[model samples]
Target: MSALQEELILSSPYQEFEREEWKDLNGQFNLNLESTDIHSLHALNEPLNMKEIEEIYFPLAHLIELHIKNHDTIRDDSNSFFQRNQQKLPFIVGIAGSVAVGKSTTARVLTKVLSLLPHKPKVELVTTDGFLFSNKVLLEKNIMNRKGFPESYDTKKLLHFLSAIKSGIPQISVPMYSHLEYDILEDEEQKIIEPDILILEGINVLQVTSQKGQNNKVFVSDFFDFSIYVDALEKDIISWYVNRFESLRATAFQNPTSYFHKYADMSLLESREMATQIWNEINKPNLHDNILPTKYRADLILQKGSDHFVESIKVRKI
Candidate 1:
């Protein structure tokens, strides 16, 4: 490819914002979150300070609020045009990223802030982890090593769940996944009852899984009113994964009931090596071949620097 072709290929339909510029967009809105609340929101090894909340997430929350309002307005207009009373569906937001990229914290903080908006919207969070096939099923399929891959997920069930929610069904129940147990909690379920907004976070929420020649194909993202992708360099993500693994080795992994309990006996260096090996073999491949390709599909992208703080944001121009 020539230089012109390369430039065109690299160009994106996004308006980029530096951290300082983005903070200004928050305006005079007061986020009523206390220090304790902020502390509670941080994921393992993911540093989220008030500075980040104020500068990065506050603006993001503001933008999502606008989208929600717009959705409501459009719904009202459509209902009036059709001369019918239509039930208002929940506004769904999807957050996607690679493992250890901090998308979970983003989803949690966004849910908290969006719920605290002036309208006090009821926000519910659901992770795609719940949709993963059980270990027994994976073993039967011989795809245990590809646990986070698309094939490991029950796409039909996930679609049904999202479809039921979109159809304005009440009292929808979703299975819950336990990180400690490393499997679905068969007895525990999350009840979502007519939430004003639903935030779905996972590594593959933005992925496209439809096969060719399939009529009326629907994807998980088709349910999203807005979407975000948390992004970072591969090296930084590997470092974060290793750091989190080491931290968990000293904590969650030590639990005898934990699926990763064996790792708890490993030394710091050994844990790091194991983490790196896992990332290289599993997460990295998934990130590059599956997750990263969907980054551009997000309505917004939060780009993190080596220090793990969001350095800039990219909003889709169209």
Candidate 2:
């Protein structure tokens, strides 16, 4: 085993279980159970199956639970010494990955599984998509083509949201964005109050910017208690993106009010070409420049095969 792999195994809570044995244990868990499959929580149209949940997300949720318990104990001990009544901060998990790598599915599954845990009934999942610049702002900047790039998001607002959650604010409201409308709804927001675990899933959640001549300030990563990078081969991801775009063209994009409605009438070949152009010009570049570089920094890495199935997991040793 590589030194990094050895370190990961040693630090992981499930280190005692052999890989095969762990898979068996995970297989025993029926993800289809009424309590386990949360339809309301899923952001995507497709429903995740039990095997996918077991093979990929169950272990991750278990790790998060362990981290939360340990963090609470440490906080209590420190508070006891200081003789104060400060509540422990919520355990924040950052999920990062390239576009169309099934990260949204992974995030949703984690949210569902974590909430199912008896110890943590209140689990909130927030996507950084909400922090993206409004369509008006993007149009004004004339960078709508760079929608998923690092500069497309309002980093300051995202940082403040993380800060508030870290500070243990009683009630935190996060703005909601609609892909169909291609805009963030000003009035609608998701309310998270006293959540035991907070999952912040985004493409650039782990990005770190170094200011010249100053102590490096870790951006969103500083607030993360645990981080995960959902990974797959570049070619596979591109294929998935094109497939997803084709699927959306027939469905969401067909809506009269949808921003991408114009593409709905295009032929399959034309749609594929458009998808390829967008992926090559926008998403691929952003993934290479901003997202892939942060993969090594994750606490756990979930590696997926071409079929969108997680083949292996690598947890970083602390």
lDDT of each: 0.90, 0.81
Listed per candidate, the RMSD to the true structure in angstroms reads 2.4, 3.8
Question: How many times do residue backbones clash in model 2?
Answer: 0
TM-score against native, each model: 0.95, 0.88
lDDT digits (tens) for residues 89-177 of candidate 2: 88899999999998888887788788877654688889999999998999998979889887788877888998998887889889899
> On a 0 to 100 scale, what is the lDDT of residue 141 in model 1?
88
Tens digits of per-residue lDDT for model 1 on 1-318? 999977874686888899989999996666668889998888998888888888888888888888888898999999999999899999999999999999989988888888888889999999999999999899998989999998888888999999999999988999999999999999999999999999999999998855333443789999899999999998899889999999999999999999999898998889989998999899989999889999999999999998889999999985
Error of 1 at 256 (Å): 0.7
How much is 171 displaced in model 1, in angstroms? 1.0
